[model samples]
Target: MASHLDLEEQEQLEQVKAFWKRWGNLITWVLTAALAAYAGWQGWNWYQRDQAAKAGAMYDEFQRAATAQDADKAAAAAGDLKARYPGTGYAAQAGLEVARLQLDKGKADEARQSLAWVAEQGSEPAYRDLARLRLAGLQLDAKAYDDAAKTLDAVKSPEFAGLVADRRGDALLLQGKHDAAKAEYQKALAAIDKTQDYRRIVEAKLATLGVPTVVEAAPNAGAVQ
Candidate 1:
């Protein structure tokens, strides 16, 4: 009986060895690939953390320069951020901040360059959209009506849709397209939230174009609580 049991165990051991001989390479390869992938993912997580830390430091430096009203230092810091961290959100923010500073100091062309960088290179859609909006405003101020209209056309963020339409209307109006401007203003009025003060601006724009807007009345505060 012991001899028979030993024979059965030997046969099972042979079966397992045969199975390993057939599939060992495949199993080994699969495990190797999975381990490599996990390592790569971990490496990527570390790289991203390092990048964010460095970018945050640069952004803080830019903010400090800006706060001290040091235009040259702020511009330098912004340039460095743009050059080194264009892939990071801090670059877009620094671009916008420096652009604002430049504008306040009457450096319209420099501000335009900064805003254009944010509009074209920002990783975030919202940042690009905001940059485009401000850039279009600068174009409008310069009386580049066609350019302003074209710039506004590039703003596709849903949150800024109404504002874009309003700007488009202003551009068209400046270009003497009164009917088209009025239509754009109407779209702005339709899309803007009633509670927002910006909606009132759009309403006024529509009113100027002879389009009457029916204002929504405020609910009675004491009706229910």
Candidate 2:
């Protein structure tokens, strides 16, 4: 009976060895892949956090220079931020600030370069729209009517539709396209928010073109929270 029991134990050990031989390599590979993926995920999180922290520090330096009204310092800091951390929101904001400073210092060409960069490369649509609007305004002031029109045409955000139409009207008016300008102003009036003070400015613009002003209706009480 003991010998029979020993033979059965030996048979069970052999079965276990056979199962390991068939499946052990696949199990090891699966566990290795899972561990590598986990490590990669952790590394990605660490990298993002490090980038944000560095960008934040750079932004602080830019803000200090801007507040001091030091155009050269601000421009340098902004250039650094944009170069090192173009993906960060701070970089786009820095570009806007740098452009404003350059403009204030009568560096029109430099200002245009900064604004063009933001318009072309800003991560946020809103920032790009703002840059385009400002850039078009500069072009208009310089009497580059065709360029201003082209810049305004590039603005595609619905939120900026009214402003773009208004700007387009201004460009057309400068080019002596009175009828087209009037039509654009009408479109601007239709699209502008009724509550904005700027809407009244659009109304005044229409009046200058001999178009009757449309009064905005007051909001219904039921529509108020």
Residue 59 lDDT (model 2): 97
lDDT of 1: 0.91
lDDT of 1 by residue, 38-157 (tens): 999999999989988999999999999999988789999999988988889999999999999999989999999999999999979999999999999999999988788788889988
The residue-by-residue lDDT of candidate 2 on 140-160, one tens digit each, is 989999898889888989999
What lDDT does candidate 2 reach at residue 144? Answer: 94
* CA lDDT scores, all candidates in order: 0.91, 0.93
Off by over 4 Å in 2: 1-31, 215-225
Best by lDDT: 2
Worst 10 residues of 1 by lDDT: 215-224
Residue 152, model 1: lDDT of 86
- TM-scores, one per candidate: 0.89, 0.82
